[model samples]
Structures are given as structure tokens and as C-alpha cells.
Target chain A: MKKKNICITLMFSLVLGLCACSQESDSDRPERSETEVRKEEVFGEGEKIKLRGVYLNGDEVQNDIMDNYIKKNWTERFPDVEIEWEGTGDLTNLLKTYSATGDLPDIWYSDAASATAIINAGNQLNLADHITEDHFIDHYVNPEALYYSDGGIYAVSSGIDAFYTPAIYYNKKIFEQYELTEPETYDELIQVCQTLIDDGITPISIVGTTGWSVRNFLFFTILMNDDPKAAQALLSNEIDFSDERVVNALKKIEDMLNMGCFPEGVANIDFSTHMALYAEGKTAMIATMSWGYPELETAQDTGVFMWPSSNPQVKTGQVLQIWGSSLNGWAVNSRSENRDLAVQVAEYCTEQEAFRHAAQGSSLNFKTENPAEVTSELEKERMAIYNNAEQYIKTLHLNAMDSAVAAEFATYTNLLLAGDYTAEQFVKDFNPIWKENTWFEK
Target chain B: MNKFYTKKGKLLFALPGLLLFSVFVIYPMIPQILISFQSHNGAEALGYVGWNNYTNLFQSNVFGKVHRNTYFIVGCSLLIALPVSLLLALLLERASAGVRTVFKFGALFPSVLSVTVIGKMWAGIYDADWGMLNSILRGIGMEQLTRSWLTNADTVVPCIAAAFLWQYIGLNCILFYAGIKAIPEQYYEAAIIDGAGFWRASICITIPLLQDIIKYVVIISTLGSMGMYAHILVMTAGGPGDASRSVLYQMYYKAFSMSQFGEGCAIAVIFIIECIIVSIIINKCIAKEPIQY
Candidate 1:
């Protein structure tokens, strides 16, 4: 009975105490805290500012080049700043959780997706206010376009980017054996797929079960052959997703599905199986972003073709538009005391000498005209893809559209493959999600 | 005054714990509840919107699917996981002392493994195109039975629940085994002497004595299954579409991925109410039980 009484008393006290803590205080706080007084009185180097930052994890491409640079150079370069780095596989979620608690890091790098998220969370610091030409921000390729809006620059790009929807890597051995030339249009690609299917080999390997293991497959169909201006207009909200052009792009994807271009149960294949199918010479072609180069390189004599567009007028090598996003952009916390220093360090991290190491090591082309030297055949192939293209525009995801539209479209990847949802259904189901989000407004 | 000091001393002893609980658990709820009534993304508090977030959630396309999936997973835990665990516990309890000890130690092994590792192993099993599942199906000449388990919306939740079952079945078995051990052996002996078999004795004596243990298992399993996130996240990542998302996954999607913290907080408040109901049930059930013997 005594033990029960103690437990009841304890529970009641906890409840009461928690209730007391939940109440908002009506009393005003003093403008200056004791810590501020101490900070103001600090001597040399402003009390050694600790710069908290996040970077991509081990599994990502050549992040070691940047981390190595940081390890060897950054510590020596900035003695006054104590760098507390957290290398994470999940920077976006970490930042979201941190933003909820008002615990933003001083610096964080992302594919400039962080800028949208940070600005949405009201934590981004506009770099245009602090960074100057002498500071290396001007050195990045089209630095102005990196910002979502003309108002301010929230992210500084890494000056180099890997092209998405750049090419379809095919097995040169298989192409030679079949007497197949590199495909120049969707029809020709289908002819190749049909030939491979006739030969009892899967034409194009895809990873569907891994939730977007083949993410680039559909969007590139929409954007690849289209003029950069039209894509730009769409991204900048000059047109809606319901536009005929967008629907037509979606229809092209549905057409490809109808052609039986992919393997049986393509939606359920794992990433390893997808890779093995392509690498082990079971599949003739694999369409993917530049990162798949290392895996695709495993095949004997890999041949490359620019992702063929369905538009006949926009013939082979005529459509030059490459999918572009700010590959590695770092944003600083607006409220951090080390905001200025952090911004300075962000620019410094991406300067010519060090960033080239990252770009070359990661097998990416630099934004600078005199970019890193081509070191391998894959590097040479990647360059040809980039050089062949006339212009580059970001996918609809990274630009002015609402993010919900992107997520909605991402879910439809399965439905498109399964033939459950039509292109008309996509436009019908999606327009409301897109329209409800008043982009560039509250 | 001295009596007051004695009570105050006990309260003071609990102050550290109370402060930690208030800061970590209670304080977060204050903001969440306040924000649930407001139109705020994680960025800024946009003015109050009375029940609008809640309305928006129900009105979304995937809400019904998410709820169905969540309830389905919970049902799997209750209908499938509970019985399997109880059977294992009964067998372990009936085992010889040395064998029981060995089984008890072995039961902890799966629970001790990381959820992510376990989820990945099951994902491999469920994978199509030369996966263990399809291979086994083909080996036995049952190749027609295999399908793409994770990608198909119909089977994704079941596959994920299977992963959870693999993890929790052993854990709950150990828990039930401990609870069953506390049942006085003489009651079982007397029941057997009165012409009761193992099944009859268990149904009549052991189960009646296990009301408290059963209550604990049901609540934890139901709530834990309802909050399923990491396993699903690792296995399916909430889709070939959002087919596998539980309510908490939807909350995470809305709050973090979509940056709609207002809706996220509204979902959180809903969960808080759910937790309150769970607590109410627990409190109501805490009345002293009559001895089975």
C-alpha cells in the first residue's frame, strides 16, 4: 500500500510539474544576457568561433576529396575557427529536425535543395550581402542562376555539376554483335530494345523496387529533347504543369512503357540486381545519371549515346540541353554569430585549386572553362555529353515550382510503369497539388 | 514543519528527473499543440487556422491509404504476432530448465540486432530477380507464386510487417516467458492431476494468471506497430508510391520532406490524443486482479 501511494504521488507530481512548465511566461526578458556581456568583453579572435557544419556521407561520390581538403587544408587555414563537422547520410532530415528545435548549424552543403528548405524554415543567410568578387563567389559558373529568385543568393555552388539525363550507356560489344548504331530517337531506342528482347536479353536494366533506383528514367524523357527556353519558362513558373507540352512529355514515358522497353517486374528489381544485369552483359543499355559511370564501366567497351528525344525535328546531337542543379552548395545559418566567417569559408572551400580536386575526383566537369583534365574514357565520354549539349536547365524539381508537385510526380513513377495511371490521369491528379502551392509567395 | 520537510525531501529527490521529463517531453508538446492550431511551416508562425490542417490532411489523396496501412500493420501485430509469441512462450515455459535457459538466451538475439540490418535482410529476401524468395519458390517448382513484393502496393505492407514480426516475436516471447514463470507450478500440477492436458491447463490456469503480461504486450505492440517508421523507411522508403506509409511516416513526410510543419503538428496532436487513450486504458486496467489459484 505504501509503495502504491509513493508511485501515485510521483506520477501526480510529474504531471503537475509538466503542466507548470507548459505555460507561457508573460514576463519580458532582458535584452542583454550575461553571456552577451561576456562575449562583448572577449579578447583575440572573438573567443574562437565554433563553426558547426554538415557534409555528405561515405557512400556518396568523392566526398573524400572535399573531406581530405578539409582535413589537410581547412584546419591550417582557419586556426581561429574550431570546426565541428557531422558527416551524415541524411542531411535533409537532420536539418529539418534541427530547424524545429532552432538548432541550425553554421554551415551545411547540399544539392542547393538546402536553400529551398532553409528559406522555407526561415534559417538561410543570403550570401549576396557578404560575398564579393575577390571572395571567389564570382568564380562559379552562372552564380546568379544558382539563387531561386533575383532577390538574394542563399547558396554558393561548387562550380561543377554532373549532368542528369545526359546519356544512355550501352554495351559496345552487344551493339557491335547486333550491328546496332547508337540510337538517335525514341523509335530507334525501341528498335534496339525489340532486337534485344528478340535475342532473349533485357534491353534496358531498371531498379524499381528500390524506390527510384532508376529515378532519372521518366523526367529525362520530358526534359531531354525540349528546348532549354521552354524548360526554363516552365521552371520559372511561366507555364503550369498542366501545359500540353508537359502532358506530351508524360505521354512519351507512357509510350516507352507500352513498348515493353524494360524487364519483367521491373518495378521490383533491387539496385544490386539492376547493376548486375547491366554490368554482367545481360542488359544492352542502362540510362542513368553520371554517377552510374563506375558501375556501367564494368561492362566491356561501354558505348555512349545522348538520351534520344522523341521529337524528330530535334534530331541526334541537336538537343543540347543538359539537366542542371547546383551540385554542392553550402548555406549558412542566418542567426549564427559566425555567419560572415561561415560564408567566407564556403567560398574558400570551392576555390579553383581545391574544388578541381573534388570535381576531377568525382568525375564531374568544372564550371570554369579551363576545367579539370579528362583522366579516363568515362571522363572523356562525360565531357563529350556535356560539350555536345547547347544549354543546361535544372529539372522541374529544383526550380520555382512547388516541392509537393515534385513528390506527387515521384509517386507516379510506379503507376506509369504499371500502366495503372495514364498521362491524362497524371495531369488531372497533379494540377491541383501544383496550383495550391503559390510559389514565390507565402 | 518537520513533516513538510520530509515530503519536500522526497519531492526534491525527484526534481532532476521531473526537470528532464519537462524539458524533453512536455515542452515539445506545448509548441506542437500551439502550432497545430496555427498555419505555420517550420520557418515561421503564420496566423491561427482552426482545424484547417486537420481538414487538409483528411482531404489529401493518400490519407485513407496511410490509415488503412497503419491499421493493417497494427492488426498484423495483434492477430499474427501476438499468437505466435504466446505459443513460443508457452513452449519455452514447458521446457526443461536447461533447455528453457538456452531458448531464453536465443530469443534475445533477433531483438539485439539493429532494426535497419533486420529490415535490409528481409528486403533482400523479398527482392525479385534472383532473390532468396523467388529462388526458393523456383527450387520447389512454385515459381508462379513469386511476385515483386516491395514494389506492389498490395504486398508492401505485409512484407514490412513480416520484418517487424521477425524482430518482435522473439522479444515478446521472452517477455511472456518471464510472466508465465511467475505462475505458481502447483496450480499447473493440480490441473494436470484433475485430468487437464497442457492446452487445458494453460487455458485454465496459466492464461488467467497472465492478464497483466498480456495487457502489457498488447499495448506496446499496438502502439509500437502504429508508430512503425525505421523498418519501413529502410525496406520500402514509403513507396514505389506512398503505399507503405504509416501515420507517423505521413507526419514525417508532411513535416520534414514537404516542409509543412503545421500539418505535421496536427498529426502529432492526433497521436498525443491516441497516447492519452492508451494511457487511460492502461490506468483503467491497473485494478488488482484476483488470484487464479
Candidate 2:
């Protein structure tokens, strides 16, 4: 009994001690409120300012842009400002960790969701007043798109990415041998797939492991079938996922699956595997984003085609979906002593990134023109699709969704692709996720 | 010196470990449990939510699937690992010294490699298009048997278990082998005198003596499976659509990925309770007697 009493006392003391340590105090956090509109402050020429930055440099392309281009130029412009840039694999969790510990960096790279999360935690500095005319001028994507419902700009993009457009990249040699032209409608696509399948070749290959490709396919299909407003309405929770437009789009994907458009066991195919399959000529076509152009450069004679409308009345070019989100870029830490300098660095990086996008000739939403001739044929074809688009629908779902809904969106879409859920089942299962996570003000 | 054995002195010796465990393990659990009953947005707690988080978790469709996946993999690893390890240990016990050395190294090799390397290697083997498994299937005229092993919802959990079992099977064998070596040769000799073959002797003598070690392995294996997250992350990222998510992966996804820290903490709390219950059940069911050998 004495021993039990002693043990209880010890445990109680431990709990009590931990409670004191774990309870967060507002006094511990730096006091800053709302999006502060500040005059442009000049930095002292001789004064040493050191800024720490965190960014996602996991991808080689992003790494090259940051290290060789952005950081390089920033050093040339602000030689006195010492910037320590740390590359992180998982930026969201890292920033969250920093936010909880009250040690957030001067500036960090952010996506829409991460920025929203940090802003809600009151750890991010809003840059609404810090913007210059250069941020809005000659930009295909209006800077207004970056504004939160509260009218605060938290994150700013460098430029628009070719990641906006989803296209079916086909092997030209195979298509030429089969005497098949690019399919202009949904029925025509199915017939082309059938012809490819008949010749003992897989019609398409997609990275099914990550679910993004499959989700893009479904979203683009929806864009082809429904009005741009209806698509936006679905994302804004104005309509249920069980709505006819979404259901019909899911059915079309299911039809593609049933028609053997995708290879057997496609779900196991990852990015590398699908690329290999496409490069090896095992699949006649691959459905992926225009950002995949760099990776597909080595492939033999590839051609690009936009997703055709399933409804014959809806012209293919009448509405085009662009997966552009302004919520991805640099954000300033609210509590930083060097907040102004950090914002300057972030702004510089954003501008340089825009310049790089223009150089690549794939800046879909940015009005920045390519300085040189567009050399890559596939890029040219992607340009043609962009040029032909009558209406450009920004993919608001990517920016508006909370993390939970985004994850479930991928899961349900991947399940649909795997044939584990029928179109009706996908709609029924996904409606709640849509409703639960759709909290953004329209 | 005499004072060192006293209760006060003994407690002094244990203080460091106690403090370390409390700081690293027990201390975090308190806030974690607290967070489980609050609405957390990853970085900060919003307010008290009572049992709402738990109710939400139980009501979630993915929750049941993830739990089922965890149980299936745990069950699979135990069922497949135990007998194979036992058999391997028994076989190695009678083998020549050089062969034993070679086999032992071969068995332990997978365990020595990092989980990332093992995961990637197996992913390559299970690759649908050009993986060795499919290649072999096609080569052997068993082309119909080829599958995207890690992606198929029906086969993903088992495949993950197989990868896990492959890594640990050798370690289990080495453990059993050590236990077999410790057993007195006199028992085997007596069994031989009783007109028993090697298999019969092993069934009677080796099996009974191994209860303690077997219980230890079972506990670790069960707990290990309960906490598995890396292989799933590396191989599938908990997809082919949440079909292969383990309980721990669900916890991670809920907290870090979904930013539902309260739900994540709820899952963690339940996971801790589950591990405790399983340990108790295992303790009661096996190694009833402390072998005096």
C-alpha cells in the first residue's frame, strides 16, 4: 500500500510538471496583429543583416532555380545581407514545427495550404502593402488571385507554371505507324485507345501511385463536361460531389479504365515507372501535366493533345482548366527582427522565378514572353493548346482545400482509378470530405 | 558500500533511467492525451473538444480500414515468421560450421540494411511493368500470374508484411538459434534414447524450452507491426487510395498531412492502450513458467 501510494505520487508529480511545461503562453509569442501595411523601409548600407530561409529544394529543377538563379541574383543585389538558405524535404511540417517552438525562420517557402495554416497560427507576416507594381504588371495570372478572403496577401508566386495544363502526350512514331491522328473528342479518344490496344500496345500510362495524375485526369474530364462556374461551384461546396457533372466525369474515367486505355496493373506504376514505360514505347500515350515536358524531352517523337470534351455539344477548346495556384511561393515570418529584409529577399526570388518561367517558354498564365524562340516541339504544342483556349479556369481547389480534404481527394480519386470504387460510389464517399474540408469563404 | 544496497541508494541508481524515460516517453504522453481531447490544428490547440475527436475517428471509414490493415499485417507476420524461423534455426543447429556461418550471415543481411533500402529493393522487385517478379513470371510462362503486387488493394497489406517478415525472419532465426544453443544437449540425447527422430525431439524438447524467447519475440513483433509507418510511406505513401494505410500511418497522416492533430493524438492514445492490452494478453498466454535452466 505504501509503495502504491509512492508510485501514484511520483506519477502525479510527473504529470503536473509536464502540464506546466506544455501549456503554451501568449506572452512567449511575439506580439503582432493582422496584416500590417508598412511604408518601404530602407536598409542601412553598412549594417549587417542576416536572414535565415527554408525552402523545398527536393526537386532538382527547383534546386537549380533557387541555387543557380534566385540565390545567385539575390547575392549580387544585396551583397551585405547574409542569407542562410536551408533546403527541406517536408516544408509544411518543418514550418509547423518551427511555429510551435516559436523559432520560425525569417522567410520560408509555402504552398497555399501551408501558408493558410501558418497565417491561421498567426506566425506569418502578410505582405499586402509590400507589393510593387512589378508584381502585377505583365503577369498572366493577376496578383488579385493571391488575395485571401480577408483581403490579405500571404504568399506570392514568382510566375505561372506549365504545371497548370494537363495533356495526353502520345508517341508520334506509334501514331504515325497506326495512321491515327490526335483524337478531338471523347469517343474518338476511346476509338484510338481501342486501335492501340488491338495492336498489342498499351494505350496510356499514368503515375497511379501518387494519385495526382489520376486526380488531374478526373478534374480535366469534369472541365470538359461541365461549365467552368459549375466546376468552381463544386470546389466551393456550392454543390455536392454527387452532382451530375462530377458523376458523369467519373463515369467517363471508369469507361476509359474498362476500355483498356490504361495498362494492366497501372496502380503500381509510379512516376519513374510510367516514364520508363513511355520511353520504352510500351505505352502509346501518357497523361501528365506540362511540367512533365522536361522529363519527356528524351522520349522519341512525342506529341501533345488536350483532353477532349465527353459531351459532343461542349467544344474541346470552349473551356480549359489551368492548375495554377498563387498560394505557392515565399512568406515572411511575423516575428522576425529582419522582417523587411526577408520580404525583400522573398520578392526578389519571386521576380527571378518569373524570369526563369518566361525563359522556358511554358509560362501558361504569365504574360512574360519567351526571350528566345520556343525550340521544343512538345512545348510548342502545349503553347498551341494554351493559345486556342477560349476560357481559362483556374484550379481553385488546389488553393482553397484544407489538408484533410486534399488527402482524401487523392485517396478517392486513386480508388476510382483502381476500380475499387465505381463512379456512384466515388461520389457518395467523397461528398463528405468535400463538405467537411470546404471551409474557405467563396 | 553496504549503504549502496539500501532502498534509498538503489533508488538513486535508478534515478537517471527513470528521469530519462519520464522526460522522453511519459512526459510527452500527458500533453498528447490532453491534445487528444482538444481541437488541434497541427501547430496549436483551438479548444476543448471532449470525446468529439474519438467519435469522429471511430466514425471515419478510413479508420476501420487502417485498423484492419494493421491487424492483418501483424497477424500475417506472426503466422508466417514463427514456424519458418523455428525450422530454419533447427536446421542450422545441425549444419556444418562453415555452412552455419554462411547461412547466418545471409539471414542477417536484410536486417542490417536500412528500411529505406529494403523498401526500395522490394518495390523494384514488385514493379508491375519490368520488375523481377513479373519478369520471372513471364519467363516461366506464368504470365497470367503477374501483378502489380504493392498497388493491388487485396495484396498490398500482405506484400508489406512479406517485406517486413523478410527483414526480420533472419533475426528471429538467429534468436531461436541462440536459444537452441543454450538448451542442454542432454535433453536431445535423452530423446534420442527414447527412439525419437530429430523432428520429434525438436517438437518435444526445443519447443517447450523456447516458450520464453518465443513470447519475447511475439511481443516485439506485435508491437513493431502496430507501429510500422516507414515501409508504407516509402512504397505506396499509404495508397492505391488509403487501401494500405496502417494505424500508425493513419495517425501520421491525420496529424501531419491532414493537420487534424486532435484526431492524430486520439489515434496515438488508442494505439498506446492497444499496445498495453496486447502486451498483457501475450504475457498471460505464453511462458507461464519461468524456466530455471
Candidate 3:
């Protein structure tokens, strides 16, 4: 009995040792074959060039209008080219992860800052050689809009220009009832706000919790009161954030909060509720971008005006501009066998006719010629803004900084919105780090 | 002589388990200790940074806040959850056999649901715009008292702890109930015959009998609270400026989001040591001789 038990225990130990060894070998064996499979699967379409494109879906032109229309129309136009569209969550992070894995799609859309990072990481193809001087005029593209870094064109600017305006999008009925005209200046706007408040309306339904929306107010104040070049100078370290102009901008926001211009519990209200309050006519005006027009169209009788600024020199309709990169353009993967077909398909999609169609759906792109018909009134209004675009000054935060610096900016903004750090403290905390770590030396 | 050898052989049969414990648990711990000495980016090992990571952790404002919040939450959960579960278990153990089974099964219902689902349900209940709690508060003419419970730093931790308590109370109750039922009824009968009242019998017979189960519960509960992750991640997301960020959440953020793998490993190593120390202290404080009866 004793010998039998000892023998059983020894057998069990030997079996366990063999199992663990086999498991280790099995795990290690997959990688060699897996790489071969991945390479063949990703690049195996020899004649049929299937270009995968990832885009965001929403009411915005990129999603609701541009992507949907492209999916429907592009297939009919290009019978030979197979375009596979995949909508992804968190486009920036997805692209970054793809770049890290070296399994990037043929084409992807990203902001200028992210584009810079992708280029720095050596994943993006240089398109300057492909794009001729005549192509800009022929395609009705604005040559100046293409982003240039270190004196070389890296990405094409999307024709759609988000001409950001910190405008008072007021209900026409409410404005008329309160006897309010388009406020001529910042002080006059304050007076209009007071009048609306006295009439039992929440003056401005500013969404403080949505950091981006709250930031628009700050951007507007800075652009209007300070020099237009102030942002660029600060980013380049020519001017400090502690400068008088920046401080004044923050103080103005504080003053606005203290004056009860915004609704009570504005800090807690999210973007949806803020819009809902405005849409329901509980609020007199909402300070938002031109992108807000589609949502406001459903609300009763709305009109837009340029926000009045403290500086008279800063022109009316002049607001902060967040430009989209043409770098979001398509590129054929070097490893792909169907490279020629992919390039041909990319050219066809970006052709004048398709560009015009895409422009109609989105407000960002500038069209070479006016479309035969404008589908939405908001589109028509946006087109008018683009036609008269020389009147407005453009600005962007992340686009102006290095990729890493821009990420830091986003982090700091999140921190500021959380109320853990004040705006002034945020600038002080970041400026030194920005000066030290930036790729751009003074 | 042959029978003695057989009994010794039977004792040696536990060797496989011991070997597994060494390989899986003990072997991996060696690498963790080594990783604590290195600096790591997301992709590659970035050489030793001495004690920089630890020093940085000590200096961080958010880390200090998260540590305090975690202890407070754990303390509050234990104070309310443990006593209530014990009482419920004791009551159910004394009931009829059928009633005892039904109660035991019913108590396990919440534990059947995933932590994510429980978190979502609680978030909805506490939502500022349309939460049931705020709606009820408003209906009772206490509208001013209604606030965004999850967003506020003062109430967010307690609100989350209450959710944790609700989810785990059933499981703990079942554990205590099983422990109580396992005890022989002869001691209780003898106590009753000796003119011992219900309270006195409970203190002398029932409580002492549950000493082992009580020790196990305390150790498990302490470890569970220390390593709590899923509920906080799904519900609060360490939000409102890291008000309810626990050590596990911070460790995860370091490993995945920030991509500081070495520091994350270091955190895990320290966390294990802290848990062990805590367990030892608790054992010492509550040490008692086992009652064979």
C-alpha cells in the first residue's frame, strides 16, 4: 500500500512537469506562424485594392453627411475600387495604437497635432510630391490652408473650415420679446444679458462641464481683447501665459460667472442639458460654435451673430478657427500589393465633383465652385462664411504645439475643468515643462 | 510498520499542491521585485531609476488624496456591512430548515449579477438629472438637498461604498449562515436547560463557535477591500478629480493609460506587502483559541 501511494504521487509530479513544459513550447510556437499569417492577410489582395477607412459618426458632416454620402455614392462612381469603411471609437487613440502596432489602415483622419505625431513617428507618406501647384487651383483648394511644418507640406488641409464663432445663438422670439438687438460690443452684450435676466430668462446657458464649450468663451475673449498673434507667440515662447492679456481673459470669465450671466449650477451642467435648456427656450442665448446650427435648427426660430468683443479693432465675425488637416487624406500602404489602384481611388474621391459633394455635407472644406444646390440652410450660411473667409482670423491650440505638448495641454484642460487647478495655476504649471521638453528649441 | 508507512505516504500526497503554489504564486513574485527596481516606458524596459518612482508617489497630491479616500470608504463599508450580515445570518440559522435554505439562496441573488451591472444601476439611481433618489427627494419637498451625488467629492465615496455593500452583503451573509448552521445544536440545548437566556447562550456558545469563520471573513474582506477595482472603474472612473481613485485604479492607470509598466509592477509589489502586513496585524488583534465543541 505504501509503495503504491508513493508511485502514484511520483507519476502525478512527472505529468505536471510535462504539461507545463508542453504549454510553454506551445505558446512560443504560435508567434512565428502568426506573423506570416498577418502579413499575407493584410496585403494579399493582389488585383482588388480594398482601402479601409475609419471615420467618426455623428450629426457632424464627417459622420452623418460626408461618410454616409461617400459610402452610398463612391461605390457607384468607382466600380473597380473596393472601399471598406469602419467607424471607430476614439479616433486619435485608435490611430496611435495602430501606428504602434504597425497595422495602420490605408487611410485615417486625425487632427493636426496627431498628424504631426504620426509624421514624427515616421508612419505617414509625404504627399508634397504627389500634389502639384496646379492641383490646388484645379481642385478649388485653398493653397494656404495646407499645413506646413519645418518648411515642408506634410498634410492637406480639409476644405471644410470650422469658422468658430463665439456667437449669441438666440431664439428670435426671445430677442424680440426682450427688445434686444445684436449687441454691438462686449459691454452692450452684458447689458442685453442683464435685460434677459430681468425678464426671467437664464441669460447664457454655458456648458461648463463640457471643457471644450467653456474653452470657447476663453478663446473668444483672448482673441478679441489681445493681439491675434498672441497665441502663436505664447506657443513659441515669445510671450508668457502670465502676460496681461491672458490674465484679463481669465478674469473676464470669472466676472461673467460672478454676474450670474450663466445659469445656476452651470458648472455641473453637461453639454446636452445646456443645449436642451437653450432649445427649450429656458435660456436667452447659448455661446457655442457654428457647428451648433444643426441642433439649433430644430429649436423655434433661431438666428446667429458674431460675439461682440471688448477690442473695437478686432472685427465682427472674427472668432477662433479650429482647422481640419488635409493630412487626413488617403495613402496607399507601402506593403500593399494594390498600391496603384489605391492611389487612383484616392484621387477620384478627392476630385472636384466629389469634393463639392463632400463640402455640401460638411462645413470644413472650401469648395472650388458653388454647388448647384445647397441641401440645408445651415450649409448655405456656412458656405457664405467660407466665401467671405478672408474677414476672419484663424486660431488653434494643439495644432500650434508639438504633439506631446498638445497632449499635455489636453490633460491640463481636463484638470482645470475638474476644479483641481485654477487657470492661472495651470499655465504656471505647464509653461516650464513646455519650455524644457519641446522638440522646437529657442 | 506497514500501516505507519501508508499513513506517511498519504501525508506526502499534498506535494503537487505545494509545488503548484510555489510555481504559480511564488515564482512570479520574484520578477515583480526585480521590476520594482527598473524604470519602464510602455514598450521597453528603461533601466533603473533608483527610488524615483516611489519618491514621486510620495510627493504626488492625488496619490495622498486617493489613499485617504480608500481607507475611509473601506472603514465605512466594514462598519455597516459586517454587523448587518452577521445578524441576518444568525437569525436565518435559528429559523426552520426550509426557511433557512430559502434565505440562504435568496441572500446570494445580488452576487449573481456582475459588478458592472450593479455599478450602472447605482449610477442611474444617483444620477442628478433623472435619478430615482433625487426624484423621491424632490417629491418630498426637499429639492434643494438634491445634488449630483457622484460628482460631489463629499458624497461620492460613501455613495459608491453603499453600492459595494449592497452587492456583497448577500455573499457575506451566506458565509456566516453556513458557519452558524455547521455548529452542533447540543451546546445551545444544554445552555437553554441550564437556564441560560438567549443573549447569554449566543455570547458563550454561538459566538465562540464562529471564531474560525469570523477570522476567515475578516481576512477575506480586508483583502477584497484593498484590491477593489471593478466597481470603482465602471462607476466613478476615479472622477471629479480623483476623489474616489483607489490604489488598484491608480496602479491600472500607470500600467495601461500612462504606460509606466515598471512603476505599476512596483505598486503591485508594495500593495501585496501592505496587504500581508495588514492581515498579520488583524490576526494578532483578533487571535483566539479554537473551540473544539
**Each model's TM-score, in the order given?**
0.87, 0.89, 0.71
lDDT of 2 by residue, A242-301 (tens): 778777777877888878888776765677778888888899998877777767767768
Candidates' chain A TM-scores: 0.82, 0.85, 0.76
Candidate 2 per-residue C-alpha lDDT over B36-153 given as tens digits, one digit per residue, 9 for 90 to 100: 9999887667899999999999998889999999998889778988789989999999999999999999999998999999988888888876689899999999999997787788
Residue lDDT tens for model 1, A1-442: 5466556655765577567544223244333223335345553436765678876674545466455666568767886667788887767667766665667788777544345656765687777757763445556445565554546777665544534444678898898888888887777887888897788777887666532532344454445475445556766777766887777777876776666677655765556667778888878887665566766886557877777767766755555434545424667777666556777677666552345555464333324454456566875776676666666655555555444555555566655655556888877876777777655564
For A1-442, candidate 3 gives per-residue lDDT tens digits of 7677656655565566556634222235333223234445655644334567655453455564445555667767765456677676456556655654456666555445345445655556565555563364245445555545454445443455444454557788999987889786778888998888777778887665424554444553454444556655654557765677765665566666667787654544556667888899888888776667768878858876656657777654454444444455444343333443444444554553245545556543445454456666654665564555344444445434554454444344434544435657766876664665444542
Per-prediction DockQ, in order? Answer: 0.30, 0.53, 0.15
Give the distance in Å from residue A13's predicted Cα in candidate 1 to where it truly belongs. 11
Taking chain B only, the TM-score of every model is 0.89, 0.94, 0.91
- Top model number, DockQ: 2
Interface RMSD of 1: 4.8
Interface RMSD of each: 4.8, 2.8, 7.3
**Candidate 3, overall lDDT?**
0.63
Better of 1 and 3 by DockQ: 1
Q: What TM-score does model 2 achieve against the real structure?
A: 0.89
